[model samples]
Target: MHLNRALQVTAAASSLLLVSGCGLFSDSTASTAGFNPPNIKMQSELGPAEGQVNLIAWAGYVEDGSNDPKVDWVTPFEKETGCQVKAKVAASSDEMVKLMKTGAYDAVSASGDASLRLIAGGEVAPVNTDLIPNYEDVFFGLKKQSWNSVNGKMYGVPHGRGANLLMYNTKEVSPAPLSWSAVFDDASKYKGHVTAYDSPIYIADAALYLRETRPGLHIQNPYALDQQQFDAAVDLLKAQRANVGEYWSDYLKEISAFKSGDTVIGTTWQVIANLAESEGAKVKAVLPQEGATGWSDTWMLSAKAKHPNCAYKWMNWIISPKVNAEVAEYFGEAPSNIKSCDETSDPAFCDTFHATDENYWKDVAFWTTPIEQCLDGRTDVKCVPYAKWVQAWTEIKG
Candidate 1:
């Protein structure tokens, strides 16, 4: 999860594994045709729900009412399906991957970062959407995406969607900036007051900015960067490091920074912007002219799930109209279920988040794991992988 609350999925997810000999430097392009996930048979039919189901997820994705009295979705789900929900909150995608590998949990709310890893590692199974009756109500854009499906076979159900927007304190940033240049190329102007996400996945955000300004680079997909493009992005981040006051992974830290006037501008999500504003900080978030990095989370079932029937039932229940709206509104992201738009407590909630606006999301590039084989279809040279991105990120912060 990028935000403290929750966050993303992909089919091209499995495609990255096709690239062989992944290392510091390699010369090969990943081919989707060669990427064959373990031939695990898909569940053909539904069954009786188990007594309970265990879930590994981000903090706010599964609410049993312990956090806030008003935020109890799991309880109702339990009563309705007679399947008790036992959820464990994972602090990071890396942690989620480790947990999922243990096969202790029935389902997971996996983001794009971990979804592919799960698929390639044969940790999660292909979903039988026919068993999930509510799947038909899910938005068209959320279905069969590169993150949630592999070669047209669905692996998970879309939960929600959101973008990492450029957030700036109105008082510190004059004229209300509309482009990402305010934070990338011209970040020095706000030296010692700039911030960015504290994750290797953020490399794609840098790549996204370059996609427009550095046209000669021919960077098509931010996630699929060849050696040259990846280097350029790393270089840009290294330069920006001089102006970074902090690289934040926690929402509270970012909100506090903006409220204290210690940080003026950087990347953020809609929930952070809302929180900062509620605290009386004059902040505004925008999708920069160059588009922005986004997420589309999915509810995936573990291949070795102890409660397969319960997992399927839970997936269907979570995405149902009313429950989907409740979760989307509380978590502060666009609902993947179109019917959820009308079920929101606030009639205009969908409009605010562009919940049903397909065109608004056209420019938002959802997050995905970067592998040795360039995701952009370049074969002559290899692109940096996630491990390399982590090393580069550490170097940039230093």
Candidate 2:
């Protein structure tokens, strides 16, 4: 559940991919045969409300006024569409994929890592953007990408985006660090006070660092790793593990650790850093010069959804400007809808998250599934897939 907030799915999202699994990286429809999506056709026309829509999502995504009475957006949705929202909070992307496979859920707010698996496994269907009136207002950067689409066909509406940042205690750390090396190369300096994200996807952070530090590896993209590149990243993590006081997945535990001074420096998200600071921890977060790993979540429709129309309505309603702003602010991520910037409670919120800055995002490597083919345009060798990454993460943790 803690990972749900920082959300590291087991996917390998790369920043510079122009094509992925028979699909263009973004907006380009061309696909290769090895990466064909399922044969399911998108719904041509939307129909009446089905009265009930079952949803599986990361925590805080489907808030129904239960957690904080003022934080709910679900009640208004139900009244407007006559759709009874039956929401289940999924602990991780893996769980989200498993729940959608059951055919009980109508939709899911899938992160990039899970979205690709759902599309490839045929658990979700291609979305007809025409049926969603609000689709036009969505940020172009969030659409037709490797994670949420196949062969240029979109499978879901983008939910939001956020980056994994480097956090350090201002007083304990001598100087503000500008690169990932603060955790990898100089981890011993911090001794048993460094922290890192606990998930397979975090392997990309190591790979990302090596891509800049070890150009001899010729690592073009962090997610697309040949055997040699993958080994190097794994080795780096194994070494860093010695200095890591703990690997965090839950937000509460991390906040507690930071506030207690048990973790002086480590990987973190903006939300966690904010909470820790509010709790009197002298912490500051930075994106670092090497950029960072991030996630872009999507609202995917289940292929076996029992209430398709209502699910469609929910997707559109959630991404509407006001709603998108609410979700983005409460969830502490950039909104997928461009107009949402204007609706946020704090006018500077959009700038703070770099919500509308395309150039700023070029450095953020969004999470996506790594496949047999290299994501960095290397045709000479096959890149290690996500399964290998999972195995390596377990070994590194052990």
Candidate 3:
């Protein structure tokens, strides 16, 4: 619920900023640092084995009939490796977890929330970069990320990332809102017409705000809420509930809500904004002055993966510049690969999307779901943990 509120505030404010020429800007220094070339290896220490790789991923992440036939990124890898591909589409983190339990999926494109769950559950295995020849080419920032690594053992390959931006319809709202306070503290401007993402896990967004705005309050992890932090986030959401038009999980629903003028401001992703624009809606994704929360999806290998070699092959193929660019374009997120961002067909892609811009990146306070310890900066004590966040989410939704 806190997460939903955070998103709602973000969506409403972002739409206002974009129309006022305050949209995201590219970070040249961060882009250059992110794009630095990885040390290349001539061959994979682990050779390709004969098998099929079954990947559980989001829709449109793999080949999804949207791109040119000649430019399909996965075809070359399939042809060269002789590894058959079986892709299953999953919509949410919960669905991904259920699918992984079957032991049929060899790999998955897991977001930060699900990656740790998989690693902790022993559903995924630690990656051996040496076995993946192109692993050296991956950006160092991605390689050593906290979400994909546990105690120095890496669990997955970094794919793409984006913030849960604040976006809104410019024609409907005026005097662009600058901070979350406008959306939460004073939401009367668009009462009964606002919306938020309908996911229980979004409570972390609330914790992020408290961490920045009320650090002295001594709240623990936002996801793992103590009575105090939980009350704070929930109180914030209860107030927000009055302003929401409806809680949404599907992109089509959000897009339709925005297009029909049924909803003016709400929580959204860059992909949703791109889709809305293509559908002729005057919407824009924004990064507020107070910052926003986000996630990075990683490609993780199954612990009992039957096609380890094929999985590695797929990982190597997807992270390449050309393939990374194609995926980024399709998903509407900034590519993790610096080279891939450079090779994108549209010269203005990074600038428009704010992918490689340091100014934009620094402005955002990206979301990394709180785990065992609290992320709300209460070092003096450990408050409620992520397990609690999961439980509280169920109660809040109920």
Candidate 4:
């Protein structure tokens, strides 16, 4: 937990970060903020398991001890609930969205980028939290967020979260950087040694920084960007791109770049910093003063779920105290269940990740799919959508 660097790794969220794959929606269908989706009625009550539940998930999420004998959590759930778990490993959110649309699966461990997509498209149903008893133990901060809910109704159960922290080579960064400015306005100081998270969502990091630095810009939420504000953030990133040596999408790539001094400073998750430091990179990761952008992947039930009862059972099982702790530690993220903190093998794990600290996440804008209707709830102006963000990202990179 050095420098309080703790996080999750190698999941759909990780791969989602590397791709510009938030599907495009036209202006007509873009404003999903408060836009009422097709009402897929949630299950009012649970019944006997359907014998099996097919799931689409990130690599490490739905384990069966096949990967690591000691890491299996799914087996016990099957034994307890009598519902067999068949999991498909997805590499990215787009693939997850595609998989969900086919109605081949009952549930998905969706990342922030895809949760809104699923909800807006009516691919997932509203969660009946009343039926899931264990959900009450989940960290209060992880509940009722923009990505996992719509129209004040919950859509999924939060899995875990990790911040996009600022990592700098201790040997190179003089005077110890504090804010995101080192990678933005002062990026020229590092020249080609600077690095950044390689995703269109990265625009939020710039917008987050601008929110603190340029108050007159009146940027309320990083994801809720109007045309002028979005352009400013893009311009800032365009300038930073010049100083950046590489935009890293993989954890190992970032570690290697930092280890070889190819990147002296840039965006990183806690686990990436730990791995890089362990590999002999003089690195330190910190949740900077301006806060950061992060992801809290959710366990969502498909709208067309064939095993509705089993899917509900799996959702409840995954976030149960012990299983939540095991998965959170295994995945390298802060457990969503507050009770899971006590069950974690590392007693200080929750502390390291700020799992229950609402103040810590106050400025940390969890990644949300930006829509035409402003997420910040501005009625007068039409905000940019994810489609435009993707297009702008491609042009900025060019």
Candidate 5:
């Protein structure tokens, strides 16, 4: 949604700004255009929960017994808070942003890609974590990040996190590959058997690879890339295309490919690896020496929510130890609530997901929209914004 609309803006607005002698590439006018969030005060006191609360979230984040009778969290939440829950499952970050813009939902489980857009567009309001008791137990590393905060004001509660790791069939890949170079530089060794995630966000993986391999590029941050650095990363992917078997977005498709021996190596999430292994595929996933790209989602309040009290209750309830563990175990990510580690069904689930290891994540770069104002704080040169990344991704696919 943002990519399609942004391309149109690039075509139309770039020329207008150019004619006015404005710095076209130095500013972002995509999803954030004409949006200035009002300085609204957060609710300081809890009140009676409303009768109902509407939510928009990723497919697995909110369960109401429709998908699987056993995977029900909403029923218990409703019984506790007296707030009936109704949720709409969003397919993408763009869809989440569009839904939030309607001002119909009380809250949303937003990924990094959509969180900042929602924040900048004034679709979501600042969250007062002091009011949520569970906020005190959330992983310290997940709090007050750039994607969920502005000027030190928190906008959401952490939901979960997972890394995009380098996965390979252990039997086929020799000597146990430890770097992303296996996919970028050495992919040709497994030519036509290598896979990659199908999204513009994959560009960051290439940038991450380049950051470690090509020091001359001076790529301080994968998401914050200037024209030259962006071009280099794009060129690398173009070259990598020659060896790619197929690009994937669906986990099932990837699992099938790995099982059928159609793919031997590529990028993947831990859940995919687990599923593939359960299916008897000898696959091993690694964070790689260069680290990895990852995602941490947040539950954000809508700016025009009609059930604010219920929304707050739901946010706190969702991140409480037991509920957070239930969601994390079911959704295949590390729970944001530290105490949730003890509540998981599988005794080793938290350790397997690296739930409490802050040191393990230092090298893992989380996803954030690439703004023109470089995230690394460089103002001397304009960086390639997310709109260009979207356009470039289309070309890379071609």
Candidate 6:
């Protein structure tokens, strides 16, 4: 699912508010200290739960035997847990939010944008880290991010993360694109041949560029925009629209474009880059010097989950080194498990995906779906709000 369209599904349901600025803390301070496990607990010697657990997740997060048999993760999880697993695929954040509201799902593999909404809506609850034994091993940097935690209470478990890289066919563009400016500011060079993710959430990518290139403008979080910052991002995108040959909401579409030599340079994910290469396309997921937007999908339990035991079991199974490696390679994102990359069958997977590599992470600005806090380290009185971003996005795409 395209990131922007995913966000649009939830735009009408909620508006972004201006959150109070608090002093930022490193990951060390954010870690849960002696946290209690969730109200439901499992026996150490017992087998998996003997019940059903429903999950609302993205399209490729779980495999139901439709894709390659090796790609199936849910069946093994169900077999190990002894819990019947029923899965629902959500293409966008908005769809996930709408589906979650029905209270039928026990857990959700939420992106940063939907995680905040689930927490705010009281649809999800804080995870009991003690029960999730593997939680301790999670990277410190990912443990207590702004979107996953509220009042120091964690609402979800970190999974995979990756940047929205500038993917271009090297055969078409020799030097390789280095910055977002090439796509956003000078798109005419590839006019009618460029593609970008279609959704409102993408406003953040534009905001990131403005924050670095035009600090004097004081644009903070793209979602939490004021009038000026909102206009600036919208204006920039409006100019970019003319150069866009297509606004892609589906992964296959973007991949097809790249394979057919339709799209020369545009926004894409790591998985697309890998797939492009397998298909014999000279594509590279470039980390522009200015930085990039990324997504960190979190596994969260529903507040009113029917089968908490099974949910916890699923969490453990999903994060294990073996399963983590499979999902990471299948989905094309860096694994959260530090050791998972080593277990992957593809010897070059780690180098290609940059899993467990700190230097690679530093080069890209991991996607932090805009919240009210304005994550750009702004100490000013205020920053752009979410409502403005929604309105501006509509105008930019219209």
* lDDT: the better of candidates 3 and 6: 6
Give the alpha carbon lDDT tens digit for every residue of 215-329 in model 1. 9999989988887998999999999999999999999999999999999999999988988999999999998888999998999999999899999999999999899999999
Q: Tell me which of candidates 3 and 6 scores higher on TM-score.
A: 6
> After superposing candidate 3, which stretches have Cα over 4 Å from the reference?
1-45, 64-71, 219-227, 363-367, 375-380
Model 2 lDDT on a 0 to 1 scale: 0.85
Q: What would the per-residue lDDT of candidate 5 be over residues 96-177, giving only the tens digit for each residue?
A: 8889999999999998877877876788889999889998877666776766776667889989999999999999999899
Q: lDDT tens string, model 6, 27-121? A: 53432122233443222333347589899988777776777865788887777667888899898887898888898998999987777777767
**CA deviation > 4 Å runs, candidate 2:** 1-34
| Candidate 6 deviant stretches above 4 angstroms | 1-50, 220-224, 373-387
State each model's CA lDDT, in order.
0.84, 0.85, 0.70, 0.85, 0.85, 0.73
After TM-score superposition, what is the CA distance of residue 223 in candidate 2 from its true location, in Å? 1.3
Model 4 TM:
0.90
RMSD of each: 9.1, 7.6, 9.6, 8.4, 13.1, 10.3
Q: Which TM-score value belongs to model 6?
A: 0.84
Which candidate tops TM-score?
Answer: 2
Ranking the candidates on TM-score from highest down gives: 2, 1, 4, 5, 6, 3
lDDT value, candidate 1, whole model: 0.84
Candidate 6 accuracy as lDDT: 0.73
Off by over 4 Å in 1: 1-33
